[model samples]
Target chain A: MIDTVAGLAADPSGSTAQDVVLRAENVHVEYDGERPTRAVRGVSFELRRGEVLGIAGESGCGKSTLAYAVTRMMKPPAQLTGGSVVFRDREGRETDLLALEGEELRAFRWNRLSMVFQSAMNALNPVTTVGRQFDDIYGAHRPEMTKSERAERTKALLEMVGIDAGRADGYPHELSGGMRQRVVIAMALALEPDVVIMDEPTTALDVVVQREILDEIERLREELGFSVIFITHDLGLLLEISDRLAVMYAGEIVEYAPAERLTDARHPYTQGLLRSFPDLVGERRELRGIPGSPPDLRGEVVGCAFADRCEYAFEPCRAVTPHLLDIAREGAAGWRAACHLNDPEHRSSVSDAEGPQS
Target chain B: MTALEVRDLVVEYAQSRGKPFRAVEKLSFTLEAGRTLALVGESGSGKSSVLKALSRLVTPAGGQILLGGRDKVPAKEYRRAVQMVFQDPFASLNPSHSVDHHLRRPLLATGRARRGTEADTAVAELLRQVNLTPAADVARKRPHELSGGQRQRVAIARALAPAPDVLLADEPVSMLDVSIRLEILNLLDDLKRQRDLALLYVTHDLATARHFSSDIMVMYRGQVVERGPSDEVILNPKHPYTQLLAAAAPRTGATRAEVRAARQVRAAARSARDAERRETVVGDGCRFRPRCPFAMDVCATRPPEAALGGGHRVLCWLQSEGKAAA
Candidate 1:
């Protein structure tokens, strides 16, 4: 029902112009493959300007699919079946990202919405100089800017990413894996895009490099005021960087809340995810992994996507697909979850007085 | 005696010219029977090199690996004693071969399980140890047929097929998802405890290392920068690099603004010191000085003497008493 931009803002605190750069409503994506899978089912959220919105889930959870849908870059076999992605441009026009086609789609890319993929290093032209690649992207987007102007801008971008400007002239092969990823990020930001979708950008890099690259990206986002749709399997990283986070399970958002709430999550899926992660700063103990694997999205999914693995899954969970509903009526801040326990009417019948909260 | 003991372990990769590249520099640790010792480091820090050297996948340039206090000079016996579970399950297991084919071959090769009843029981036991249910069905399945977690279990089961005294897991769960990650870690922990098997876990994940191992060795560029009780090293880390690593662990509860601010400070600090830190540490001298925030004049030239006590060791000029050697 959250069809309009104002409807998205109505869910929480009044979203100002400075807030909510991208708002997705009831997004449902399906892969019309040989098996015709319903990959993402009724997913919705908002990415405020200058804020990082983290989408966290295990593989095949459709967090990456959600990111792809937002960028209007969903690959073949994967089709955007329903819903709309409303993104406000710097020019103050609300563009329905899903509606764009052909030339408009190409122009929208890198200029308004950019993406830094999981293996971003692989995206770079291995033979070309990093400087030239940056220039090419910059030149393509801003044809009026001269070569000298492009070069000057490229150096600044490289320096902004904490990479030495001199090394921009070096080929992708010459740069370290971390350095190349940073260059890719710099290229994504070349056009000063309003929204940047990163699909596990630093997943391949070592811990130190991962930290460094994420740090640079965080810095860049702050300086430029671009909304970031950061997707990753590591909930820890998302929890740290994201203002709000959406936990996906089998192509659906099982939990959606502010980043702080994720740690003390009410959703069973979120709790399971939290328990699974080995904490760096905590009592050293054996982590209890969620038993069973994620369900195959290729098959006919009835009821909840997580029913097969969920400890708290009941008859209702296996009977019907739970819609994203606000869990807490008063205490929580616009917290929504697709789990049955979070259903509004379900909460009304259960006496809060004797509930576990006490 | 400890199940596996790596004494002053040094491994150097042979280069085309000049001195061989020292991958592991004078590393030493022991895993008591039924305990896990996690060796943690970044890409070039020689974590995998140590594991490979132990399993004889790669030959050590110097030092010795002792199996039951005796040097494992003959590599075959060591391979039988210690089996490695590699990171990539898909690549490690043969796709063409069925699960039973992969499982039964190792048991037969090691002579731990003979054909017929004993071999079948052992295979079932191996599957049970890693929590792969319906053992009979799993035995016939191929590597591609199973999910990532199940594939990892098959790899672990295969390692156990030989009844190895020690398990060397090189980032086994890194490729798996977070939800499934803990299952693998728990399985390893259980296997170590139940069988009294020593485990040498190599990983870059400090959090997982802390969760699984009692003792931890933090390596930086082929040298052990810090080694001690996992809690002490991870929580109250004395080394500058360890401190940075602990700080870099993405905090869950922090707002985007706070996290972004901290990330900026860390990036600035890393950039400010990266180049000077790259210049090869002076041999027989403190290697951490260049990157150290509290580097002094003595750190530039003098090698900090080791301070070892209660299964803990730290090499830093600050920890040194500055007393002249006898």
Candidate 2:
């Protein structure tokens, strides 16, 4: 249960490098049209087995596009310009996701890499019963399984999400929003996929409902031992459930750290995002949101995408694009930030900054 | 000054079968000028129903909505004094229409501004107020051309075109980005203060509700479980449901044990929530009793309105029992 707040179970130092279930290296996705948009720009991350890696960013920050690209779910016009999405099986066989096509690609998804969309109602067929949906998955994947096995599996999955198995007979509209979301989750886990990519799965639900769903996801991830990539704009919520976080801005990861250390991030965008949410337990103070809008990525960006909004942006920030540099944070390996402030030459004492501490 | 007063407001929908569904049951509240009241609830909690009723989109089955301390007011007058900013800016705005037309129509319809330079200046001023600079550039652009944040600003601008005394914003920033959400909320807060508008903010997010609103009313299945000053209600909740909401909200720097404790209580409640559908008829009992951790025998019937001073009130049997002692 401590894993929900601080991951004692998901401590990566205990895990081996071989446990990397999925790795994306220098991933790039572009939407080619009249006005071309580079949705993802050289984003890279590793999803270790049994670890919850949260991709935190706002809308159109390319987090979703990155997810779709990594999973090889990109449709026409939106193509993966460059990247290697390597999926390493438990038996130590690496499969290139971008190379897989047709039957192999269709079989790969839900068998290994599954996705839970933002809206469950949209994901689920309104016309079909929830039980039939599970049966359909079983029919498609586990064709050798008996009818009774499929039925029993459906019952167990429904019960796993704390929903009554009897409700499987009901349509998506018959169940509540939370129940529908839970059903979608249950279906996603039907095949017991190695990695589940949930993109804002609980955004539309209420606070209580979202919390319950998150808790359930954490529980199921522990019980089943599967890695998860949870994406959301809610930095506060992400801080709670994630073992490690990747904060993205305008298609690039600005900061990567253990969930606990994100509040003390070196990136101005991450800090601004952390401050954006009003704490439910803290002293009430007025929050001044970050001013200015994100730069249009349709055209080439010369420097930092967040430079226009950064309070600490200086001369070098506008002229040069900051690369992701390793920062020092105790007990957290791979703590990095893409900011000029991370460099000593660019470091200057600001009223809010915690200057250069290893 | 009381800008709007609502007493025993009951909103019902005609069901195909059985009795009419009571979406809101005897809800009572007063909105003061230059103050924000947040109605916090999940789906089926009737926060939307209340918004619909307040905006005159749906007539209440019962109760009186007294604007400026009077129940009787002209329809045009009521409309001019009360305006709404919808949840989805994309759907709220017409795709074919420009930003100028949206703001201009409201101003002209309400007699806030006339056609020609008067209307043009009013539209530009409205756009400027929302921080959409070089007003002419933004005014000419259609809704599709603008970003989500900019479109929301235009929606706010459109809402302000009539210069209403009350602004009903329904999840105005939920659809927006994290960084942009605060910008819109801060803009709304500034506009509220500047215009001295009575703002009724309805949303599912507790953190924003507590921060943006002076008062908060936590609703559960068409009934308010708790109502109080924002900080008091969130910081030290008297009701079980409100307590759950406060604890369930994800916050930075939360202790593991605290989360574990919340999770343990949630196990039983999750099952209860799954088993129980939100029935139209709540039957003269505490609405939160189904999910309440500390539900007693008295909760089966009706709980007393236990007042915890400072305008904080709870409709829980536990509060009623511990009132004299605590």
Candidate 3:
């Protein structure tokens, strides 16, 4: 079904056809139990080489689960039920990430893809020195490398993140929260992967430290030329960093568009989210939060997941599900939204009854 | 009316092997009724300490906390007049207890209710005030049964149970989802207007502070570096720290080029000065001087406060001298 939506023209940023790095197609993940929850439902997106693609959503919206599933990191009780994750290497070799098993999966991970987990404090080993932790990653992957080579790489990685190499001998407890996060980033870059997935990497840090870490990541991405899949609940940060964004709501991608075009989003849910945040620089307007909680994923959703909270929800939104389709607009061609309001035939009828709520 | 006045307040934390660390140093601010004063800073910047001091969670090392211009107030009266809403709704609420029980305890303890029937009515009213509709149905649910936004509403309802004149919310909505945070903020704003309650909202995010509060104070380390009306302070920040914070907060309409420019400005500013690494300092000079982009020889000594009109004041040598010359 997504074949119609696939092979859309490259973004005007000059991303050629060969720049596609990772493509996730119709992926579904479910948390198995007595009443299983479908965490990620038919989510699909493609990431280009050296491009920053952001996944924005609230907590429990399955954004994080989708990130874990793409990296093949989902543990027991949470299993990927369907779809494929295809990764293209530097030499144009394609590998189905979900099909790999055992040692093949191990070799693919960290070499082609790496992830920086949320809460950087918990990501590091507290019992061992930071140097040893870096050594552990290199040892597992590059077993034949000499200890001196590992130490040299560790020192270089530390310096790259602006941490002194001398601090590598200290335990995780000795470093501040920001430094620990830098260490984790260094570890992720140890294998020099083609893509790095960071899940709320700076959520625990202060705003200043968060800015510093973000700056470092941007600098590293530019120099190292690795694509980034940054996931966070902060749409503000996403708009600043992401070249393209996919807004997730209740286990589904509601809107996919260029980051700059998000300000004029077509989806009501996306518009609501944009209006929900308080502005730092602009004139103050009364922030109207999207009322009501997200739908329970335990039960199957029939229509639009955001129907209850959306003021612009119409009849088709309650009876039939809308598929993600291209809704071309000036300066934002190839923009897709899973909303009936964008449908030409449906919009003509509904637009007369209701104006845009946002 | 001035609901609360904190004068030269100091908060200290005892270290395991060294002298007591001063978390908040001579911080002074006034909160007027029906208005909000936001204390904005990063983690470990003593914003939470001010809230803790107001709630009596931490004893002040020195200075007076006056109520309505009076230096002394009865202990029970003080506790009743000032209430606190914590950051984490999940941890602040009792998992096992129903929402009714949570609100009832505060009401009964404050002598707002006498019997079961009265307590029940008060609990229902509290829930209704926080906009948790169908109060009876929500009252029977446990904290675990509620969503993050609903749990926070219950926490706010419990805080209002004491009929407090002042509310201290320490990052009340930071742990909540992005979509739900504004609802809680709007709720607090509504309650402040309806009840004429003075609110002290503490958070690290400056954007939300400007949205919810009328007056804003930017803190660094343990001292107020700049303070003024929210719009004035945010729009025309006199202090470098305030400028950095404003630029660092991601804006919704900001383009990637603008963001990159802001980041470049922050990076240039950060690299201009050597950031101090020491945890504790004992100097009278500006604590932020180590990382200040405009640091001068005069910053090595203590700087006097400069009034910038419109109730905006900045503690910087350059500003003071500029004002003196003018």
Candidate 4:
């Protein structure tokens, strides 16, 4: 019984004049096979211009799938079942991303949008030199550029990511894991795309190296003024780098809010995820593991997906799916959560202690 | 009593030419019953080498591993007392073999249980201990049938089948999801307390190490840079490497300014000379000197271990000189 219309109208972050770079409407992604799995279910969100939007979830929660769908990078077995992805340019020109095919799609990629895959260190060609990889990208997207110009751009890109430009002559195996990942980042930014979708870009790297790479990305984003969709299972990292955060649970965005305001998350799933990892600088408390496993996506989800595991789950949670609605709370301007407990009518049944404090 | 004590343990890998590359150098630590020690380091930092050496998976080139204050223990007894739970559970467990077969093998080999009913009972108990409920169903399934967390639990259960005094866990929960990781860690903690087993938890993540262990040892380039109580090392790190790791780790409630400052500090610490010095300098000087922000002329030579009181020790010239520069 959440008020969707009122909630949508009260979005402080979203306005008519404000620029939204990308918008996904009712996105649905499914893995097609003998047992078809609905990976992403009715996910909708708008990526603001020049802002880092972090999508945080567990491995099977479909964060990566959503990223792929938005960028139109879904391959066989993984198909975008339903959704319209609209990419809006600076001049208010809107293009349907899902409609782009073949040559148009190829041109759209790297020119307007780029992606840094997970374990992207392995994404580099082991046999080819780092410069050759950059050459390939430039060759495909900007064939008009001369060979010497490509080389110069390659060197500049390498230098931008804090790697020695001379090392571009070496193969991927010659460089360290961190350096290889940086090369991937440099290549992703080579075309200067308006949007970059990074899927757990730093997951394989060590903490120190991870920090350096993220810092480099933060610096580059500031300079280039490009929007980013950063997807990872690590909430702490998402909180640190992202301006806005989306918490996905069982193929849907359970909670969406500004990063700073996520500390007071209204969704029970979000709270559980936050409590699962030990804080580096807080009072040591026993980490509470969410009791049950994630729902099997192959089966039909009758109600709220997290209902089985949620401590605050009530009758409505088990009977009806909750829609993502803006929850009024202090210091949480545009905060929204998909939970029955957040609804005004459902708040009375639940104890005040369990309800989110405004 | 000290269940296992490794004194100046050194492990080397033979290269094609010149000197054999030392994977672990003069690494020493003691594991007492009922206590957990976390070995924290990045990749290629010789953390895994230490684990391999202790479990006798890889023979040590130098130094000795004493068991119960004795230089040597019988091979059979040693196998029963020391067991290792590997990092990758998927690869560690045989895919073709059932969970029952995996658990029973250790128990039978260690003479913990005889054939038939005895082995079955032991397997069931082990499964329950690791929190894999409905033991009969889980025991019948293969490794592939279980989730990542369940597979890790089965691996732990198999390791515990022999009722080992010391457990060597190498990045146990790193492969699992964040929600399931805590369950495994909690299970390990419970096992240690219940059985009084000495546990050596190895991981590159400092945050989890601080939460699960009582003592923390930081390793860098096959050497112990810092060793102390987990709280002391995590909160008030003395070594530059440990400080860098602390600063680099993404923590809850970390501010943008703090993250930015840490990045700047790390950038300043990565000297061009350090990269070059790594290739040429060998056993003569402190391994961390080149990258150390507080490095001095004295750091060119190996610095003696400095006692920082309350079981905390740091290997740095500045620390030895009481400068507290870093």
Model 3 regions more than 4 Å off = A1-17, A352-358, B275-282, B322-326
> What does DockQ give for each predicted structure?
0.71, 0.69, 0.75, 0.68
Model 3 scores a TM of 0.97
Reproduced native contacts, each prediction: 0.81, 0.73, 0.82, 0.67
For residues B1-326, write the lDDT of model 1, one tens digit per residue. Answer: 49888888889887999888898888887878888888888887888888888888787878878888898546667788888899999789999998888888889898888998988888888887788889999988999999998999999999988888999999999998788888898889889888899998899899999989988989988888888888888988877778877887777657667876787687677767763245687666667677787677776664554656656677676676773332
What TM-score does chain A reach in every model? 0.92, 0.93, 0.96, 0.95
By lDDT, is 3 or 4 better? 3
Ten residues in a row with the worst lDDT in model 3 chain A? A4-13
TM-scores for the candidates: 0.94, 0.94, 0.97, 0.96
Instruction: Give per-residue lDDT, candidate 1, residue B204.
Output: 88
lDDT over C-alpha atoms for residue A263 of model 1 = 71
C-alpha lDDT (0 to 100) for residue A119 of candidate 1: 85
User: How big is the positional error of residue B119 in model 3, measured in Å on the Cα after superposition?
Assistant: 1.5
Cα-based lDDT at residue B117, candidate 3: 90
Per-residue lDDT of A281 in model 1: 87
Worst 10 residues of 4 chain B by lDDT: B271-280
Query: Lowest-scoring 10 consecutive residues by lDDT in candidate 4 chain A?
Result: A1-10
Ranking by lDDT: 3, 4, 2, 1
lDDT of 4 by residue, A85-201 (tens): 889888999889999999999999988999998886579999899999999998899999999999999999998898889988999998888888899999999999989999999
* CAPRI rating of model 2: medium
